[model samples]
Target: MSNAADLRAKSTDQLNEQLLDLKKEQFNLRFQKASGQLENTARVRQVRREIASVKTILGERSRTA
Candidate 1:
């Protein structure tokens, strides 16, 4: 998990790409859970929080700009 400081250091475009990747992983995790193929259940929550963090950082940048 990346901390706020690390996320803040990233450019907005990099953050956006990261957010998109996390969203895709979230979707795949959901499918894996449904198919009973998911072993790392905790990852779902981690990804969710990561997505939120990226969005929060993006929002902060937009507000500041």
Candidate 2:
């Protein structure tokens, strides 16, 4: 998984786009799990961590500006 500090370096709009993309990926991962097609279960954790990273960035930005 990519680090939160790296993810937080992007602009707000970029962050939003990334967050959206990640959510889509997370959905797909969940679908795969349901279908018994998922090979890497750790992916779900990675997606979750990324979501948390995005939210952390958003929160920090809001408090600063």
Candidate 3:
């Protein structure tokens, strides 16, 4: 997971890519949980937070621009 500072340093395009990947991972994590194969359950929370962080950063940029 990326910290807010790191995410803020990335370009908007890079951030969008990161967000997409995080969403994909989130989906896989949900699938794993449904199948009872999820090992690191905490990862689901981390991914969710990371997605939020990326969205927040992107929103900030968009609003300011």
Using all chains and alpha carbons, the TM-scores for the candidates as numbered come to: 0.97, 0.90, 0.97
In Å, residue 45's CA in model 2 sits off its true spot by 0.4
TM-score of 1: 0.97
Q: Each candidate's root-mean-square deviation in Å?
A: 0.5, 1.0, 0.5
Candidate 1 — which residues are off by over 4 angstroms? none
Tell me the tens digit of each residue's lDDT in model 1 across 1-65. 99999999999999999999999999999999999999999999999999999999999999999
Task: For candidate 2, write residues 1-65 as lDDT tens digits.
Answer: 76876887788999999999999999999999999999999989989988988988899999999
Q: Flag the better candidate by lDDT, 1 or 3.
A: 1
| Ten-residue stretch with the least lDDT total in model 3 | 1-10
Global lDDT scores for all candidate models: 0.98, 0.91, 0.95
TM-score of candidate 3 versus the correct structure, residues matched by position: 0.97
Q: Which scores higher on TM-score, 1 or 2?
A: 1
The order by descending lDDT is 1, 3, 2
User: Residue 38, candidate 2: how far off, in angstroms?
Assistant: 0.5
- Model 3, 1-65: lDDT tens digits are 67888888999999999999999999999999999999999999999999999999999999999
Native-to-model Cα distance after best TM-score fit, residue 24 in candidate 3, in Å = 0.2
